[model samples]
Target: MSQELGITVKKDQNPSEWYTQVVQKAEMADYAPVKGCMIIKPYGMKIWESIKEDFNTKIENTGAENAYFPLFIPESYLEKEEDIVEGFDPEVAWVTHGGDKELEERLAVRPTSESIIAPYMADEVRSHRDLPLRLNQWANVVRWEATDTRPFLRTREFLWQEGHTAHATEEGADEETMLRLEQYQEVIEDHLAIPSILGYKPEHDKFPGAKYTTTIETLMPDGKSIQSGTSHQLGQHFAEAFEIEFEDEDSETQTAWTTSWGLSTRTIGALIMAHGDDDGLRLPPRVAPTQVVVVPIYQEDNRDEVVEYAEEVTEELEEKGLRVDLDDRDHRTPGYKFNEWELKGVPLRVEIGPNEVEDNAVTPVRRDNGEKKMGQDREEFVEEAEEVLENIQESLYNELEEYLQENIREAESKNEILATIGKNRGYVKTRWCGKESCEEEIKDEVSAEIVVLPFEEDSKPATIQEKEDHIDGECAVCGEKAERWAYFAKNY
Candidate 1:
């Protein structure tokens, strides 16, 4: 393929540049006029719509409802929650004036919606019968990320869904937090086809004012970990801040428990790094915008006949409920169309020519592994196409699963921790004292921090306590007593 029309760098050699090329060449997105924002093209928007539609189904089953909220939040609302203001102060963008008039109070561009949404929840949740209230908003949020700005990964303005919920008790809040994390894992793994590790963020790294935060973390081909999704158990912190009180069955007033969870377009960056190759993106069939492209091959002599038959095959696949496209452009050669579809990561391609039209057959090629089946009878290929798509999904996931398994390693000393991250840059499980100072030491030296303190082998309701109880070793940094496992890595 020519450099101008295709990926110019190998993914393994220059991943940062390779990623940018694939995203633009595939027509997924483009950089906006704003420094740290991106314009989502139609092809990129379709992937996000698939994620949104799929997540809506899973969350709606748990009594969650979608709602809209204002983009601007007042300064008083943020000050009401001390942690919200403190945690996001450096990143928060404020509007000081309107038109030519100085505003009485500043408005925050909403680094997050906790301060604004909590007050709304307090107004609605006033009784035990009004418990387990869940509200989700699909919106854009802006943070002033002045350095290391990249498309989708760390953009200043991006789209996401933040779910704010109120419950009667802490147990209900915990259940809600873990449930959302589970649903996010399904979307990331089953749809995006990436492997993940679900665990707790160390206390210092947890969301500000949260009782605790659970995260779904995934690794990239470059060995850096990505925080794909996060579910925070806010407990009574937000409830008390906003005065979300309720009357219990015993006629006693009690403070409600609250939780917040979110998954963003950053996961799309994970999808690109996990499955893309030098050729370009390798989207799984489940979420691919165009699952199959039917490319017709013919010379001018028999172009009409070949083009007509290719349409029949396309319609057949469409009848089988597949997203099919017939690339019968007269000006483009079959070779050019193949490279285009492959760059866009269509999971499968069907090629037809005069030979197949006369034989009443079709040839199917797999995008995941480039395996081509020759001249299958047309009647049998419809169901076979579905089977091929299913296999491509599995193969893409398995490739990442194997890579993740191979990259996670164990470290028991400070030098070992630094050495491991310096050389490999993947997850390094180390015996930790649960002290931020030790993490700071490694981070200062190598720029790697604790990404996760894994949950116990069998414990589920988002427990780091059980995990804490099981570890017995000296601190990797201080060599004092240690009681936890911390997975350290350089993250994006």
Candidate 2:
């Protein structure tokens, strides 16, 4: 645990540098030869596996089946829906040749599986019985990005689960959209221990071809906003484009309503930014690859006894359903092991020394607060470890909750909104006559745009008279009456 091998920069001072150091030094991930791509190391991959298992279980319980789709899409298929193609065209990576032979129709590496999946759905779905087709795929996608490639944040290729569903009616599609978003919120907030804001993206910010997009936005420590997850209501756009029609009970053919939602490796970036500290990554207990690490402190006199006791404790903790690891390599010093585990950000550390062994108690240290508490009976220690992990999760969430509240400000005027965004580095809650022009104007003027238009539009506070008045006020940029209040921010 030398300074050179650990994070040297403070997060508050140089967050970008600090993050880079942590990711590499902690052996989480490594930069690949290709720019904008990273190799997920064993530790990093383990965390992702844990997250995937949890989400897979949740979706499976809700009747979603996992499936695989082609990784390449024909250019013509993508162009089936004009809006989707236009939105993704600039970012797509196309394969013009196959093994050196020129190809007639260029295939695009899947930026998303929508176009490829849609046409297949059209072929497979023929009647109302196949209406609610819920298919999810865990796959890799390529999006050719131009700038700022942070390991998990912005990358050329990344792993994610994209869930695509087709329903018989608009109401059913809407319900599916919200239900998936709710599940995402639960997995992120409760399991990942990250607090998030649920809202709808503005028309301009919605997914390329979606009728409307719902998202969960979480605030990072640096005050930037990270979109944790998103669910889109596809209306009849893709259904019509792909000719996915169903014969209803009434005997008429109608386009099926569709929805697609995704959660990506970027969520890992959010977790790092949200809860990590100078010590290193602070993973939530439920998702931590190693929830607890037992360091056996030994001396020549009691080395054997201390190591044996540590193994027993590790076995007991494992039996109690904890991911426990006993560090008995006999090579590293106790002090060194502590630093390594802290840098790796294990939620709890148990130090077993001769004194603790004699006293029948162990020393417990919490990663979040670095608080040391004397253990009790072995059974009690296991129970308290469980409680401590939960406490850490809650405390980490509350810390971010306070940050979100403090960073968000209610702005009354365009100038106020700009100033708030510039100074606070967070979102500005303001009244926007729901006009696309107003959103454009704000973007042009201050480079900040509407991120989310809350679903609970009518529940805005009464004190915001300007917002209420502008409910139909002329567009902030043009002269059209506003349609809704929006959360505006400069996004990553």
lDDT of 1 at 409: 94
Report the C-alpha lDDT of model 1 over 1-492, residue by residue, as the tens digit. Answer: 666779989999999999999989999889999898999899999999999999999999989999988889999999998998889999999999999999999999988899999999889987899998999998999989989988888999989999999999888998899999999999999999999999999999999999899999999999999999999999899899999999999989999999999999998888988999999999999999999999999999999999999998899899999999999899888888899998999999999988899999988888889998899898898868898898899999999999999999999899999999999989999888989999999999999999988776576644555456576888889998887888999999
After superposing candidate 1, which stretches have Cα over 4 Å from the reference? none
Q: Write the per-residue lDDT of candidate 2 for residues 6-72, one digit (tens) a residue.
A: 7899998999999998888778889999999999999999988988998999999997999999988
How far in Å is the alpha carbon of 324 misplaced in model 2?
0.3
User: What TM-score against the true fold does each predicted structure earn?
Assistant: 0.98, 0.94
Q: What is the lDDT of residue 469 in candidate 1?
A: 54
Distance from true location, Cα of 76 in model 1, Å: 0.4
